[model samples]
Target chain A: MATLKVLVTGEDHAQGPEDADVTLVEYGDYECPHCGRAYPIVKQVQKHFGKRLRFVFRNFPLSEMHPHAEAAAEVAEFAGAQGKFWEMHDRLFENQERLGEALFLDLDKELKLSATAMRQALAQKTFEARVRADFTGGVRSGVNGTPTFFINGQRHNGSFDFDALVSAIQQVMITAKSA
Target chain B: MAQSGASKVTPIHSDRILPAGAGAPNFTLHATPDQTLTLSDLLGRPVILAFYPADWSPVCGDQMALYNEILPEFQKFGAELLGVSVDGAWCHAAFAESRHLHFPLLADFEPKGAVAQQYGAYRDADGFCDRALFVIDKKGIIAWSYCSPVAVNPGADGILEALEDLPK
Candidate 1:
């Protein structure tokens, strides 16, 4: 996370549109409780910034401690293929414990994804590579903890609180607008 | 806030920590092949006892990644790095796979916080071990040891330096 500010350029980024005013890229672990706690703050940033900001999720699972983190990313990836990656991402983070491999398949059906296809994807280790790539990029980005953020190409490493996020964004917005 | 340094650290009451120059004590932990590895088993080789605060903390991530990067060096020096935490073996396997990490994340679960307590690294209120590193020489005597606050850490290079300084 400390190195995030220097890592804005990389092959692992998920691009938004050309004219997006603010691009918020996050390096996060699925099972890190701190990441879970940051979920709401990120949501608020999206709310506060609205269409002016583009938010991206980068998976940085701390699988060493939380065995279910990578699978959780896969569930989101599976849902992504069905055009619901964000939906599934939010769902998995909101209820991480309930989304193990068994629970993931169940939720796939709940989210209207093809359970058979989803299972196949998981079996094929489809998004495993993508998750790895993101994690490796996270390493390159100096991401060591959950919910590491880059607000407009600058890293913010501190407590996972929303007020902190809002202030950072507000300061950036004023500076960007003035410039 | 928790007390800093020696006065605040009492492993037996909380995590069971061993002070420097003391015996590393005997304990069994789950290794990479899913086998139980004991401190006594690694007696013949110099051991790098890596204590990370948690599996995914940022500093901890850098610390383990650093060790993985220097695995060959450690092996050349005839050493084994054993990471201990409250996390389970199952989590360790996934952790290794995800990071392409080439080390073992020993499970200090069950007996709850016994090993961490033994090392005086556990913070009972937080339910996690603090960052601590110990280098035990081949004879099973601690040669060098260092501990850090939960958020900050001393780099792995210092331990490697200590290892080189310790009698090989």
Candidate 2:
């Protein structure tokens, strides 16, 4: 029984309603190709479920393998501080192949973020600890790799493809309805 | 938790682990085709013996790759990682190179699960080790152990936590 050691809390970055019927948490790496492939699928699942779903994203960067991952995570956390987490998060996945300093700066401009503040934040390593905390939380939650999902505080031990994810979420919905 | 999707066919993890404070069983196994590594030689530093089923299996590969990526973290606690499998030295060598693994993978092949059996990790029903992990202290005392489901990659957090808990 490999379960999530850490349950989702308010301190976490989350979307949808807190009282949603189903919760979907993803431990993802910004630079992972598999996670990039999963981006659209997760979006589709969100659209399908609508108000029935709550979404949370946590960082679990494999920095050694993905050199750009740590920086990208920090950038997302920075945007999160400015109330623009989802904006940066969506752009990161949308432009997974173009991950770098240049991309972060470009995103800062497009998102109407203060370029000077963003530069100082990166220079001072701000949000590094926050991103690292998210990573540590993921590790404690039994996240072995990127794009690991949890449904209702339990590890979703399945292929994260669109169909599999949909079926798993629907199962939760059915159980909730029956209960 | 919910055992849906990839976990439908996966077996549950049970209390099949070797308990902590027990003396770690020793062995000599081929690390490279021409090189042999003995357990006793690594008694001074904490050792992590990860006995997995075989090379190239999806779960095992993911587990090893994750360990490989986190090798430095294990090293920070002055710990050494060794992957043990029932595969031959040549197979281990190829797998190590293909995955760019930084740790030595000992072959438990000659006697086929001999070392794994001694560690109570061998799964006779499946003819392989049941994806077990053992963290041994400097004095060769087992500090902690876990038996993960064959289909899952039981990441390195437990091992790291065990290392951090080692009496200083």
Candidate 3:
């Protein structure tokens, strides 16, 4: 197998699902401004690539740096009950500070969700296992920081420009075709 | 009822400030002397919040020392700096005392990640943090924020340059 310079499995490399023409997995913290910057970019890639791409998200919440991210992840998972995962996900990234019990209720009201049900879900920590799985996946894959990504099985370090992502995907596609 | 509903809207980050251009947010962190220190306390200054995973890590040690090396330069640019981690306040005290760190190493241990949440540098699996840096101007809005790979060292000069290029 031709080794890849961009990634290492246990070192600086981040692991994710294998064998997609394009796989986009992001390691993000809900409270990170840069992660906030990268949010729309990931959405752009997902929207542009559609089903041709497999998108995965892993947690690399720098809780030492972004303390509220872990709590917010739990909150989002709790909100997943009403199928509000994406909504809570965006809300967290957009406004990271309102991540306590009170804010969750307020946000539920704003989103017209069942505050009572959401509170129950959160108290029970229904999404603990799922959040744990995502974090475990991130650690196994070597995601060392926030806002990291794996596109088509290739690890991308640093912030990305739109054109760079397209080119990387194009290269992967070409190699697959030749193989 | 509508007014009550409007009042019900949650303030996004009341204790925290948004990352905006050319301005910084007022932050009152629990510092040494076990009291509060605000961004406004350091008025007419830039602030650098250098976040790291663990105090004992090789790269983090080097990274922390870099701040001292550029202490004069940072002072010249009118910036106050601090290092933060999820370590307890006592741990921060010891780490700073042993390393002879000129700046305070903040304690973000309570709730396991208060400060990290402010900067977005928490990692759940390892229960440690990845190195992240946040630059704030005198006014207390986040000017620039960068999150680096775990083992990497963010160049001191590069960050200083980012500050220098700013409109004075």
Model 1 C-alpha lDDT per residue in residues A49-160, reported as the tens digit of each score: 7777777888877666667888788778768766787878888888865658777876777888888887788789998988877766555554545666778776564444
Q: DockQ of all candidates, in order?
A: 0.07, 0.40, 0.02
* Candidate 2 or 1, higher DockQ: 2
How many Å off is the CA of B85 in candidate 1?
A: 14
The most accurate candidate by DockQ is 2
Per-residue lDDT tens digits for candidate 2, residues B1-168, read 112355354564457667898999989999999999999999899999999999987678778878887787789889999999999999999999988888999999989999998888988888898789999999999999988777777887788889999986
Ten contiguous residues minimizing lDDT sum, candidate 3 chain B: B1-10
Candidate 3 CAPRI level? incorrect
Q: Quote the positional error of residue B63 for candidate 3 in Å.
A: 9.5
Model 1 per-residue lDDT tens digits across residues B94-161: 77776778878888888866887877777788888777888899999988777765654444555666
Q: On a 0 to 1 DockQ scale, where is model 1? A: 0.07
| Candidate 2 chain B weakest ten by summed lDDT | B1-10
- Model 2 RMSD in angstroms: 3.3
Which 10 residues in a row give candidate 1 chain A its minimum summed lDDT? A1-10
- For model 3, residues B92-149, the per-residue Cα lDDT tens digits are 7777776567887776676776557655566665576656677777666677766655
How does residue B133 of candidate 2 score in lDDT? 94
